[model samples]
Target: MALFKTSNPALGTKTFQDAAARYGGAIDVANRMTLNGTVNRTGILLICAFATAAYTWRAFMQTHDPADVSGLLMLGVFGGFITAMVTIFKQSWAPITAPIYALLEGLFLGGISALLELRYPGIAIQAVGLTFGTLLTMLVLYSSGLIKVTNKLRIGIIAATGGIALFYLMEIILGFFHINFVSINGSGVIGIAFSLFVCAIAALNLVLDFDFIEQGVNAGAPKFMEWYGAFGIMVTLVWLYLEILRLLSKMRSRN
Candidate 1:
């Protein structure tokens, strides 16, 4: 199979190629990867994420203190990053690390969502609805052949994602100098437009992820690839949710 590009670090150009090499070309009948298995694994990861997320959310709701949830937020942020790196380098360990990633990310999401909800009230639920709504819409389009993942489209999405990531990185780096991309991150029209654009890019990355995961299934990758595929999908979902949350925050701040 030819290489393809995606903004998702988990579903990079050679993700399946590397996975294929992990096990020999011969397929294992007992443990061959299937689309259904991948979907099931994804559901499990999502459940794990939401379970931890709910715990953090309840804690914040009860305490009503950002300080109380700061530790969970930090743990989720840093811990998820480390776990993602580990899973990427060692795909076979995805079964172990992917769920951990989901749990840590859930903690992060819960804490951040609690903060946003504290100010914006119903924003977290709105973001969650939009995020999942986008996911289902994309899945239908992908399955119905409405949103074809052409090489050119994939390249465009990957470029846009990389640009967004670089933009965020620059802002983070400049934050230490008491400088940031205020215009883009602010609640102004331009900021809102930027967030909308970013949210769209993040959502479209789902199409890319779906296509890539299906390709893996067709290639008869190993059973463990199910976990890797699920992990990749989860990463995109997390990104989409965060972007939606940011966009909603910007919109709400305007009013």
Candidate 2:
């Protein structure tokens, strides 16, 4: 049985296990995954994301019109989704698809952040700081063994994440019918509380990602798996950043 599991769909329990089973005997030590390699790949992905994000940010700032970048935003949404699906099914293609995924997400995030920053001045920087702070804090806690990824903790996080995903899906469906979840989406007490809970869960997911990546490194997976591992961490970081942005926006709206 796999000894590690994560709430992150990109880093499922079977991911490393299956990779190890299939590639362990074939790949030599030089071509096997390593912790440092994964970290370096993750940094490269972050740079890729930031690069495109800066472009979209500047474009939006020049026009100051959401309509101007709406097309790019949509492209990022659908393109990133398709690329993520491809990477998940074809893990070997991660070395290529992962950077593409980051770039697309950057487009989406940059447009959204710029739009929000117009409403709440300095909100974008605030969100970025909080996101990285939370990431660093979680890393320290996980590294210090203060936040153990026990079976119970993993299961609980997985269940909570699934529930949140379902809720978001339902919200999207409701939008088709012109239904609005006022209390949950508005800048109210309930909405703020819900955002806080989500932020907490998203941060906890970083711990799970950390644990999952460590397992991948230990399993002697192929070198390409390093890209896949970085992709998984990127997924979690994106989620955490978006959640933190939403929470910050909600709080600012109340002010």
Candidate 3:
């Protein structure tokens, strides 16, 4: 038969309306993955959120204690391990694993936030507010067509992310060698500027996440892609929140 046909009452039209409809529906479903499959991803995200808040409060309460601060320092390793496991075994951990990763990430975020708050009062709130603000701003820019995500931009983002990750690794190595420089968080004018630059890159990641979801929908990806999409969003949000926390911490130190 032909690729498509129309069922008009008068003359038969060669329009594949049914095929088009099916294709459109698939795309719509993919795009609405988060909304439609909200039960799974949202449950994980909500649990993660609650964990983060609780951990943050616990950290805050113990901010003045040196031993608590020491323990908080270990979050980097713990969170990094969970993230690596998730990424490496995305297939194996698509179900229960993502939520586990989220919880571990929340613990790390909470610890870091608490440490920062101890050093700089009122920074936790600032970081939280800024994270949400940046998210909303990016959403607006994306919807208004002010920002277009291109393949080249994706390449750049991936490259920058790699560079940032490498820098942290180097910092850890230096710490082990007992040759700490400016400060892992940065210091003085140079540190604050660097923090701002990193924060900007984190914000840009959100733009990429938004574009990826839309593209996945247009490409008619399977429904499981919604979980994948939500996972991506969670990663970007976590990074953005961390960057904001770092920036706020720097500002607090300066003041």
Cα RMSD to native, each candidate? 2.3, 2.3, 11.1
Model 2 worst lDDT run, 10 consecutive residues: 1-10
Best by TM-score: 2
For lDDT, the strongest prediction is: 2
Q: Sum up the clashes in candidate 2.
A: 0
lDDT of 2 by residue, 86-129 (tens): 98889999999999999999999999999999999999999999
Residue 25 in candidate 1, Cα distance off native in Å: 3.0
Model 3 misplacement above 4 A: 1-47, 59-80, 183-185
Instruction: State candidate 1's TM-score.
Output: 0.96
Per-candidate TM-score against the hidden true structure: 0.96, 0.97, 0.75
* Candidate 1 segments whose C-alpha is farther than 4 A from its true place: 1-5, 24-26
Kindly report which residue pairs in candidate 1 clash with one another. Answer: none
Candidate 3 displacement at residue 65 in angstroms: 3.0
- The lDDT ranking, best first, is 2, 1, 3
Q: What's the lDDT of the predicted structure labeled candidate 1?
A: 0.89
Lowest lDDT block of 10, candidate 3: 3-12
Give the per-residue lDDT digits (tens) of candidate 1, residues 1-255: 112356888877677766776673776766778899999999999999999999999999998988888999999999999999899888889999999999999999998998899999999999999999999999999999999988899889888888888888888999999997888989998999999999899889899888888888776778998999999999999989998999999989989
Regions of candidate 2 where Cα sits further than 4 Å from its true position = 1-6
State how far residue 46 of model 1 sits from its true place (Å): 0.6
- Scanning candidate 1 in windows of ten residues, the lowest lDDT window is 1-10
